[model samples]
Target: MTTSIAQPSQTKQPQHVDPAKKRPKVLIAGGGLGGLSLGMLLQQTDIPYEIFERATEPKALGSAIALSAATDALFKQCNIYDEFVSLGKKTLSLQVIANEQRRVDYKMDFSAQQQVLGAIGHVIARPALHDLLFRQIPKNRMHMGKKILSTDDQGDNGITVTFSDGTTASGDILIGADGAYSAVRQNLFKRLKAHNKLPAADDVPLPYSTVCLVGQTRPLDPAVFPHLLQDDCQFINTLGENKPWAQGTVCWSIIRFVEESKTSTDDKNGHSIVDQEWGPEAAEAMCNEVRHFPVVSGNEVNPLTLGDLIDYTPKDLISKVKLEEIVFETWFGGRTVLMGDARPLNPAGGVGCQNAMHDAIILANWINALPSDPTSKDIENAFRSYQDERLPWIQTASNSTRFYRTMASGGIVAGLLRFCAKHMPAWAKRKMLVVLGGNRPQCSFLPLVEDKGSVPPAFQPSLLATKPKTPATSV
Candidate 1:
């Protein structure tokens, strides 16, 4: 991990927000799941926040994501789980496939993703979850088109964020919930370089192959997803002839139908979701290249959304998951701390959103835990506690997941996937799931279930099962 200082902008220093206010003003950048979730969580608390989103509208980029049971606790706490129920499909089975052979069809959640094994979660469409969170958020709190151009943490008492449009807002604190390509994190990198505290150059290209496509479709003919709902998560892996394979090796894994466009009004006009929402034609292009499997997640959902329209015109661009750094050099420095993809930035292990949400959960709790009339030391203590409590597992999950993805995706390069898929016994797959999904060495911080496995006073599997994957440190 290498962190370098970019020249700081010749901008004015940040003005301070009144720290004595009962609800500290917080500025959140980026409006993805992390930003929205953070905002929703804070709303329940006394913390008032201003969420800044560069995009003019809310768009679901990428595809579906499986929220682990642990992360779902935070959602439930925010009181939006029921809203998600209407938008998401309840997955309940785990089935593994290699060519035509069914390797393991265990009862589990996230069964659709072969990479996951133990921790049961809901593999939901990004749009659905986004809508749920957006709906729950107080409409007045959102500033849709404001793009943050620069941020300055005064270090005295607050941070000030300036938008590209020349408007400025000051907050008692700034939470960098921005995505992987984060501007706030970039500013922190520059600040760290100014203070001379970043890591040295050690980043190199990681060789792996995982070209994924994101679209939506209905569940299988007899409702195959219901079977996965039976357990925690369901994962189906297809070990290709020349693809990668290992106990935890995951080369060809699919996320199934987890993303959707709630309204076509955005697309019909110029307004849209994320820049990545693909219509039918672009999805077809991806299928034409990625090789169409037996109605993988996207293929099925595309038809449902684009009915009677045989072909979709091109707009959204779909691409492979090719990257170099799984972890960034410095996530936070001084008064500015990075969270979400801007934090760990792991490509695999389904940790990105997890890490981001955990950032919110731990940070919000820490601040709220502080004395009502808190001091700078109180703020600093909260910051330190957030890092100390969350950093260890995040570090471990980042290294572990990166290593896991490297090995699984490297099966082709190292001549492992094909050999193991053909020779490895069925029992090996089950054991792999235990390690990959349950009791993962890197992410002990994330318990299989949240709340230390404490059953609520009203113990209901459906209520308990509605949880999504908890905060992933790797994200």
Candidate 2:
């Protein structure tokens, strides 16, 4: 099914009101996935909000994003789960291939688990998902190229934000969906440190020893990579042990058919395609590193090399980055809060995007629960509640990613894990898969976003409770 991106229709702006008389206005910085998802939720709830992106226009710049059941639940709450599923390939199994011979060390089949858990993972191109979210947002509410310079909490008046262009916008609450190096976080911490409230280690970068290169090949021919095209497979990972030549576990995540091919006039979605070209320098460097890396298919007589995958990939789509892990100790202060990569996590498990979307859903739910004319204290309580509910899960996710990275890196523990995964009884493996797939945080609000209750407790704000009917006031 081809999903068409509808052009945003222009609508008259709401009349400007005095800052003192306006209801709580949400000022979201960084219009990436988290910000846009939050904006969509706010729009659904009829809450006043705006999203700001530093870029001139929406450009899907990253590689593929894997959506877990937790994230799928958020999509369902927004009534877009089916549309979202239609845009990506269902990921049913994961194969961990090892060494130059392309031997399969461990495999996880998710088909049966999907049946048991009621949700299966999907791997989609980042741009397609971004475009899907972008189309639903109101044009006037999404401000492009507006880089947020700094934010000020104006006590009873709310928060004031200044952008790179010297203009100013004020809102009752501010959200720092702005990624890792967030200006909102920086400013908030500066003030907190001045007041002796900031933690000493909160400002440093998380340590990282792994480098990752991600890219997509054109529509893959089954004959070339049959394993990737199989009904029960979506991604293949080649894991290597530590060597003198390469430090840590060197791993490659090879994803296929993440997005459908684009036509000259439109994307799989009927919207006009925005051309994003990749340069050769990065691709050349990546190809040099993994030229001899091997990948195997059950049907093929011989294994394929990483160089072969690169050869088929368009040069412009390749991206390289160092994999780092950082989970902030604090997520909010006063009326300003952080979401998504701004909160930080290890990328090993490919759950960063899912977690970010989860943050948006939970935060939006809390904000929507606030009174019609919430006080600064009311907003602060909501921020605290949002952080308190999400921090433990975020930390768990970070630790899981770090642990996976360690297991992928050849070590005594990695060997043990691989052996267990390979030799475990079928019943035990299915039980483990059921546990892994079943235990995920879910959204708890309207439309009864139901999934397997085997997961952890999600923040379920009292939907039936009415907001306080206080006089309209600023932050």
Candidate 3:
């Protein structure tokens, strides 16, 4: 399940010329995980691409961690996994510790699978990783202070982009590694929605009830969160008023584990886990409700024509998102198409980043089959092969991410479901496999052909083959 990029051994295919190779002048928008990742891939390759980040500078921000197999290897492929690992605290398991009177009722574990996936959830400040990636790619290639105004698809060629500065430029490919709510995807979706290329609103809204708070905290001193130091697993500490309290009452990010991977305790001065915390004050607030405090309703009636689930997530959670999905219905106009989330934004399963990384690796392998030079059709077919082979994995991971988060947040209902699971047959127990994100392909992002609906190529596993003796030891 860990990420493995097999050196491909495919039958010989027609050669394609790298007309856009060494002259790679890609304009990547939004310097987030996807953008930074693609830029880093390009940086490592013979291609050249520049990142146009909307932020004036790479600012330190966003909450914490995510688990991915393909992404870790992508970092390994790009040669940055070790550096990231050293900076991140690896989670070996996803434990569900059902709590009763503050005592452990039961525990469900997930780690061996994470290891096989080559990544457990990784914890690093968003800014920290961004700065690291920003530093990895030369400063000259990454531009700050520029915002995208508009993007237009040019006929049979490329994309024309207009910047906020009133300047325009054309590129062979405009990779909109933009995060969900992407401006690029938005315009494209506008066109598509107008043309009815979108799924019906009812089928898309797909809602579930969840009203929860999600945030991080100041680095907990070892004494503050003793259990966290003893293990490397992320936890859902559930305490029920009934057999199903669903812990948070509504679904939200819960932290039963806390450990900071800062170089020195003194270095922890800058990182803030979240802007708020739920403690005595919160408990008191809950005990005393403010009448008409203002109840807010949400929009889940229609999922966007573009992006992923994110556009539907509450705005309050947007800033907290460390990594967003890749959404591009089109990249490279038509000549050299792009796949993966980079196309229509990869879904947010634990493997989004991994999936994106897998895309690059698969593309590299797919291209290797072609002769040193390739014709336009050859490149087009290569793109098709890449899509046919990789899309299913991307889809599977995306669906898993959505499913896992849903169950994780499943309030009393989800908890009751898990509790009832004990009485069910062994086959029913396997249902939990999806919540653990154990049922998907090992690689996060393999290539794909939408029409063909393909599977991924071979891949290897990660160092997390077994749960670390404890989280501290692993970090």
Candidate 4:
């Protein structure tokens, strides 16, 4: 049965607040999920924004994505909640198994998510979600093949960004919504270092301990993979004795955790360090290594191998990426600011993209608060507020990602942690679930979705600060 959600006009026309006041023209670097989501949110406002993507064409990279209650309201406010549900498969439970031993470790039940949080999360393919966000944005606003080479905050004159083709675009503000190796972030940090204002932590290279090979197969035949027939998504995660991998409903990932020293140089997959170039050659190398590995979750009688699934997936959809977890101390300097994977989380947790889109929501709310012809201080203040509101949550998320990494990476510590998690009390588990699902931020300027969950949403300072002011009644 399909999930029923309130239907709002997905293509709601832009609502301008004040025609006399000129809003800021935003230059957004990167046309990934976060940037696209931000552009979609900005579309509902008077803000004029343009998205720059380095890729000449879109690549259907990565694997599955779980959309949780944290951004349920934001989707609803954007009026794309129904379509998101249609494209996604609701996940009820997660089964963790010991791969070599062929024993079920524990199952994480998420049935309470709907009752307590009002929205049980769904697992959708990354490309599907990316396309969904892309649909909400106008084609003209999104510029492909324009790589952001550098940016300059022109003080009172606003900001200007130079492209790889030597073309330039000037705007009131520049937002780095680029991925982990963001060019906008690189330029901003360079400027900060020149002025001796860059933080010690921000100056260092992004560190990672794990690399992942992820992909989603073309729609499978239900007779061959019976789990595909199930109404809810089947998430079967396995902790290998040595290396770890996980298989979702359709998407799968082979995660190999490396020593810190090994992370900086190279991996067995032949993919270069840091510069995670995703192409057929690199992905084929990793696929060959894990192809022989048995897929315990698919088909009992026939027993499919990882090779079968790899063959099932299109070559273009596969991607290999280093799972980097870090929250930079410096978020903004001058009129240039950063968001999304500019500060990424370990993909092991699957919350990185969610947090990126959430960052867009919060940042959009703050940006929407800026006045026409605002001063440099005004722009800085808005960016500061966005960071202050998101930093604590990101720190919490980073710690959570590390814990997930420890659990999935496998070792004495992981075993103990997995054991503890397996036997964790129900009430404690519920509390943790609440913590994970609680923050449901919406666009402050849009009509609010009614809160129906028993658990109230976490306090959003951006929403409260930018809420519409009530007019005073004349005596």
Candidate 5:
């Protein structure tokens, strides 16, 4: 069964409000996917917002990202669905194999995702997706090299964020969409800890059980790489003794999980652990370590290796990063809130980017409905509403991510999961797909996209709770 996308009959007209209108001014920390997406959503409303990034310029950093129908509605509402589909290749199945023996373990079918959930899953290079999101945002609103040093939530007076360059900016709301080692989060945690209001789990340094090295190769010739000739992506995973490599059409990630959490200040060799660092030196080290790993996608006669992919990838585009599994108990406080990697997750299941965009969608809904002159209580309530609607979904995604990670491991747990996955009934698989792709959150302020799946989407509270009272004007 296949579900067809119906073009929206009407498009929502972009809100053109006077710049001087006293609406809630949003200050976003980070210019990655989350921040840029939130900014794009906010652009549809009368809300004022600006994005700040620590990087001097955007680097094409990450490898591939998997997007499901969970965000297809939001993309259609934002008028970027067509372009997103064009840039991505639809993924039909995930084939997992034992790396050393080259034996097939199990294959998870996603061909029915379109029929059951509304849209097929897509796998695109992260840089291409990032560039697509970046193009939607205005140049004037996105500030580069503005590292957030600290935040001050001044009750009803509004919030203030001080940057590394000794400059300050004020806004009605502060969103920490920065990555795992977020300065905005560190600053907020400091103030919460001073009052003994921070959760013990949220106060400590982020823990990581795995390190992932991700990179995308330059476009390859279809003649040389026969897999590239396929119309749809064939997602593959090769599970080794301790290292698992998840392969996309032109991108890949080599993940090595440790037995225990490595959260120490320094490595065993006495060198400081820069977990968030994506510098090429660290990436190169990991690249060389996994260069000889076997790739299961290629034919036995022409066996491919990680070194082939690495050689095709530009040096500057590779990155080594940590994967944390904890879903922080506290998401928002006062006027400060967190989104994206600030509330980190292990990306074993490729749900991190999806959750980040979902967070932005929900947060933007609540922010759009805010009163122009909101009091502290009103601000707090809005922030709470954003978290209330987003937290449960984040926790669910985190749980699934962990389970998938375990399933890819070489332990007994992984063996059991593989057995179950191989024997999972077709009905069970479809049910799981429905559960996984059910939450298709859309902007309440924009014209809603018609649902095309057989199964209805999960209930979205933010859509009903924060919808604009007046019908959105259409172009």
Candidate 6:
């Protein structure tokens, strides 16, 4: 409850050692948000680490992401909160509409919630967030186009990671921050199975009943899209009538402000737009689905349709993908461990990315807490502690996301929740917000640079964020 971070020990300065001789080198798989964030944290702590990514280039190839109050706290600790706030658009309220009638059915105002929690939720393009994290990491430490083929635990010496390009690297520990289809996780499970130590139901794919299509629209004209400019409400969700589970459609659209200045196409950081590829068939199919669906707003005379939004979006940015859930039973073995999507979790609650960031912080904390020249057993123990501290919260967040995804998927429970959410009294809604928004974990090593204000005692430091210098070149 409101636990303040313990300052670094004044008497014992962290011993600097030759990285090649004494320091334990951390090998990170994947270069997504979690991996990159972890690299930044390790840099801040002077922890030796290397990041390997299969992708040939650093490209943020997704739509928008919602950063909650908890995530906002992490950003502030990392000294990038101001950058994020400036680049992203804050969402004040959520409006749910009936697809058939083209009218607003429910609205969840977040103004009160923001005031209570002291952190406002913002919606920003995925690429923008990626660029922010990527810039913080040094060029030499990040290795792109290196696909990991397998990993071998070399007992006390270290772990050997073999890449697809016939190269090998040894590190004290291996972390799987790769996304859903993680090669590191696959290898870990395989090794466990070989040793007959695999847990029950450990590597099953997450069940997904919903298919989502997401894209960002080009800068909107305030004259043509006045409702989109309103800070009062930034996001809108449209749900079909209740149907059998996983059989109905739910569409979510947000007008993201990719840039603050209309005249400037280039971001304030001077990065030009990176092109992405979404096949023609996929784009056509997504546009076909919502071509006629009304884009309803509060009492607007005429609203745009899904097709109009897609038309405004760059063809390359649109994407269609199924949403799935997975929670791994085992997170670590020997010198290798899992984090972010590799751990058991789903992407529904809009908290997946935030949780991924949390994983980096917690794991880094445990790792950084070890001695400068830690033994193999010491590293293993730190990993065990990392899983112990994080597994329960990860499970809770996964369940919450599952519940929300089910409710949004159009079913009996979905109808019930919608009814309750629509008719719930203001006080009841506030109470619900308090319950959902409480107990968020902040970074432990970083001091709270900007307090949003007093939050509930439930808000405490369970994770830590870090800063990095120099940009890394692609391998």
- lDDT per residue for candidate 2 within 1-475, as digits (tens), equals 0123544422323323335444578999988888888887777654689888888978645667777655776677666777787777677766766665566656666666555566778877777788878776888799998887777898877899999999888989999988765678878887787788888877454454555566666666566666554443246666654421111011234321111222223333222232332235654655676667665644456556666766776766666554445777878888899999877665667778888887887787688777668888998898888887777778778777767655565668877876776777878866755544443544333455556534333434433233333488899
Error of 6 at 353 (Å): 0.8
Per residue, candidate 1 scores C-alpha lDDT tens digits across 1-475 of 0011222212212122345656556788888888877776666555667888889988745545655545656655554555554444444543444442334423233342333332345655565567666765676788888877787877756778899999998876677776645678766665666677766541222222333444333233323223323322233444444432211111122322112212222232222233443345555554554342331222333412121111221234232232223455555555566677665343455666666776776666665555554555666666776676666657766775655454344235424543454455656755544433332111111222344322221122222322233676873
Clashing pairs in 2: 4-270, 278-316
lDDT of 5 by residue, 257-363 (tens): 77788663644422236654546678898888888887755455676788888998888778887777678888878888899998888888789999999999999
Task: For each candidate, give its TM-score against the true structure.
Answer: 0.65, 0.81, 0.60, 0.94, 0.92, 0.82
Q: CA lDDT, every prediction?
A: 0.50, 0.66, 0.44, 0.81, 0.81, 0.67
Q: After superposition, how far is residue 189 of candidate 2 from its true place, in Å?
A: 1.4
Runs off by more than 4 Å, candidate 2: 1-22, 241-283, 297-303, 425-445, 452-475
The candidates, ranked best first by TM-score, are: 4, 5, 6, 2, 1, 3
Please report the candidate that would top TM-score against the real structure.
4
Tens digits of lDDT, candidate 3, 227-297: 33443433334433322222211112322111121111111322113323334345224223321121111
Candidate 1 global TM-score: 0.65
Off by over 4 Å in 1: 1-21, 90-93, 100-120, 201-211, 217-235, 241-287, 291-325, 372-377, 403-407, 410-475
Candidate 4 worst ten-residue window by lDDT: 1-10
lDDT of 1: 0.50
**Residue range 1-475, candidate 6, lDDT tens digits:** 0011222211212234445545678999999999988887676655689999989998645676777676776676666777777667777777776565766677778777577777777776777778778877778888999998888987787899999899998988899998766788888887888898998687344444444566666666655566655553346666654321110111134221111212212233222232232255755665675676666533355566666666777866666654445677788988899999776354556778878888887887777666667777888888888887777777778788767665576557867877887888988877766655664555565554454535562633334322222388998
